[model samples]
Target: MRHAGRALACLALLSSLAVAAPAAAQDDGVAPLPDDFLWGVSSSGFQSEGNGPDSNWLRYTEEQEDKEDVGASVDFRHRYAEDIALAADMGVEVYRFGIEWARVEPAPGAWDQAELAYYDDVVRHVLDAGMTPMITLNHWVHPGWVADQGGWRSEETLRDFTAYAESIVERYAGLGVMWVTFNEPTLYVYHEIDNGAATWLDAPWLFDRLARAHSAAYDFIHEADPGAMVTSNLAFIPLTPWLFDAAFIDRIAHELDFVGIDYYMGVSLDNLTAARTLTGGLADAQPDGIYYALRYYANKFPDLPLYIVENGMATHDGAARPDGLSRAEFIEDHVYWLQRAREDGIDVIGYNYWSITDNYEWGSYTPRFGLYTVDVQGDPSLTRVPTSGVDAYAAVIADGGVPAGYDPVVPESVCSLIDPPLSCLVPAS
Candidate 1:
């Protein structure tokens, strides 16, 4: 962790230099993106697919107080086909989802063929819909057996995790699948600490183990799939990336084929929306902050491409956001920034909206970020109601990006803390 902090110091200094550097010329209009730019939607197995095998998360939810019962969440386990078709109908180019470790390997040294076959079916459906399948190998849920062995705190769990990763890559490698070895490894540690799986003192050891797991899995994925691109997406924490990326991303920096970033909010002296992060509630929209996120990564990993593995707006239980930003405006506003980043020479290859449908958000289903809203609590049918974002996203994809001279519905924040002195000193246009 100390070594990582040194690396973070270097990165922080590099970012600080942006304050002295001149901002790139603001383009008068956004141009058409490259033909291969991927437009996709994202979801995780534990968050969306219900009737799941027992795991650390399931146990945590069971024991925790005041958590919403995540019963048959959007029932994606039984209704994936319908959901895949919904995405296809919107001309989505890719479908990013997770293959649950608990479901496929419920016990140590044991495998479940039925659950594996279910994931096979899900992948086939996505391909049948003429979309690419981006599979996340872990989304912070492991089998109860692993938890019993002390979760990520034990060396034994790390060994087992690598084995599971190899098993999954071996199975899905040939299916033209893109792989995410872990979803937000930093956040994974935070959640584990929050759930009593580990203590703050254990964070350094846990991060080391996660880095080892991802590095081993990266080799296994490529050895099996050859052409497969792999990443463990980072949940971009504005202004303080060094605090989050130091222990994980810095360790596995060399292992990544591309940088996977999930940017959902921004902080500023005036707008303290980031405080909501502690509660998993809807944060205020910071559309322009995404440009800084992209630019930051573009500078950090100049040779590798950047992908927005997860980006979207969350509303409280399908209702409009308190800030009055509509789901549609959020879509257009962010895409506008994406185009700007591209025009400024950022090599961004893909953008996957945070989710296709609303599902359990870690502890509760209250923070809804899905493009297609679902009534997980009230509707027995689990109806998939299209938000205005549906049409907005489709149009963005069809037109290659937001049209020339488009203006964001939400204005850029003043003195944004997203990238510290850089963002504050030289705000993006």
Candidate 2:
């Protein structure tokens, strides 16, 4: 196995020579991103924000989850400056965080100025830290009032979401923030289903509602701040991507200014172990899958710039992986493929690592996906322990991109379905 530091320097082969014969040799070298490329890290307000508010997520964590209660959740509400400083110290360009709708509008038409002011301070810190704030308007947790009004199931909820989006836009547009209407709307419905808040039959209804919400928000944001770039990022599922996501993706395609993709795991060995086994080992983290994800969207939205709004590896409770793959190696290979995709002429504008510190993952704090691990359930200090990946990411940012001709420390899987024709027809070195 290659050491993480050494992996960053290795150049085994740029690409398979035979694969690129019709075009140019893939083994030559991957090109650097434009000097102005945005490298960033992402975290969600609902997931990271602690000091429990009166929201659906707060209720879920306290009552529904079998795992640990989200006590303080690394105290991001109070410690955002430190976390932002950690990101800024890495020399990152963007910091993607959400403005919690639940927090801002705690009750029906009862806006919380304190909550809004807290976000104002957070955004200010993000800019002062020298990072562009890519603001997400929602990350799945809604006000308890909205849940009582039927969550996404209620037609009234659509108007409520748009109003909330409008309020956020009016306040923050002048701050020069990039806007995300929603984070993984498909996954939002999935979470609701998993939490027994909705059923499978409700997915289409929820999706349609989300689409309207996004469309309304897109127009609202544009009118509020002309030339605002907005998108509702999707979780890029390799399997059934078209089968499941076409309804929403197709509806919102024309409304998006950029294609925001959140890719984590992919289908491998014909089984997505991550889905079946959430024990939090890095089960199906196919770094090369990032290449196909970028390609899938690049081909689909030929003119739009693509941003990796969220991507990272997850270990079980910040434990060392049994597979022996270091976080640094995972990150390097992930970026190497992203660079390869860019070199292949994808209009890739930015990439953000999933998170800066470990926070509550939907229902569990065990699945750790962070450069700096925070033991929310254990350590009283809630120390931000640096993983090898932190250094790996820092070097990547400092250097602009990986070296030209650099090889993936992990080899591409043969016959992988992430991009079927390209996987077998156009081989990777």
Candidate 3:
């Protein structure tokens, strides 16, 4: 791992030098992306699909006044066909979505064949639409029974989670579906802790349980589907350096088949940027931070393919962003960095926009991060309106990259110290 990190550092340094060359003279030529690069969008079962299920999150939203009531989240439960069509239209090659464990296993040892069948249908549709289906076994929404039995802190809950994962793999073995064992295990831990539900606080014990659950599920997924590629996606937050330490990252690095990253907000420990409140300055939320965050992980796992499993900007009540960073600009800036990361040899294989549409954002709909904004409140149409980002993303997908000569509008001085040589401006051909 140390050697891999060192190699990444050298590559970054070289790339920085390369970018300093003149932009016009640069190759600016097109290079073929990886043959298997996955271009897709992501959505969680609880967040987008509006079907009532007895899960910890359902209870959390209902009981917590501060959280948004996600009664009809874009009505994906019924509008899946339309939403999926939107993705297909965008030339997406993959669709990453989650299965609601609570809906599938309403009670202990009881399986809902119908729920499984529903997913089978969804996956089939995705395939028919010329896209692969990437499924997440758990996305922070555990069955209420497991929560009742003490959640992640309890050995019983861990056992149940593994068992559930095994069953899912067994059921969907030949579907050509990529599997994510868990979405952001660290974030899951934080959620448990924040909600006063975690069983362990210390790194050793907490990571021990996480490793146990991930390893068991990893083995089971491969056993069930010989071709399955599985991982536990991490949510990248720039502010949390301790979370990305060697101990925790190395454990995940060893377990995952690929590195799945959920990058949204950028951070700078050197500059000491405080966490912004829901309502704050938009310019302060720069996407450049994503570049460093990706570098942080790419440096650790140089050989493994990296997937931006989740990336998007949030708005308050679907309103125009106060800063110049509109939804369209946010998507464009993020994609630009994504291209830059790949150009720098990060082994990044795919980019999945955080969501297909607006849904319950864990707590509030106010933090709208959807390409197509859906009004969860008031409107009976349960309308899913295309935000400005929709057109921007459509063009990006169609072009298979950002437009030629496009540079992020951030201050050039910000990156002047470490900017890649002007010659590096050429898009990977």
**Estimated TM-score for each candidate:** 0.94, 0.91, 0.86
Give a tens-digit lDDT track for model 3, residues 1-429.
Answer: 655664454466556644212133235732335557678999989898876688888878888887878787777777888888899988888898898999899899999988888887888789899988999988888888888987776788778888888888887888888888888777777677666666445445666777788889988877878787888887765433433544355576676788888876543332223345543533345665565556656655667888889888778887666555777887777777666666666678888997888888788777777888887886779787888888888887777667657777643224311112211232222
Worst 10-residue lDDT window, candidate 2: 5-14
**True-structure lDDT of candidate 3:** 0.72
- Tens digits of lDDT, candidate 1, 1-429: 755664565457556654223346556677778889999999999999997778999998898886767789998999999999999998899899999999999988899999989999999999999999999988999999999999999999999999988988898778889999999998999999989999999999999999999989998888899999999999999977766777788788889999999998888877787787677556788888888888777766778999999998888887777689998899899998888788767888999998999999887888888888898888888899899999999999999888888878888788888767666765565
Task: Give Cα distance to truth, residue 408, candidate 3, Å.
Answer: 1.5
65 in model 3: Cα distance from truth in Å?
2.2
Runs with alpha carbons beyond 4 Å of true place in candidate 1: 1-28, 279-281
Candidate 1 displacement at residue 240 in angstroms:
1.3
Question: How many steric overlaps are in each model, in order?
Answer: 0, 0, 14
Cα lDDT for residue 252, model 3?
A: 60
36: Cα error in model 3, Å: 3.6
Q: How many angstroms is residue 342 displaced in model 1 relative to the true structure, after the best TM-score fit?
A: 0.6
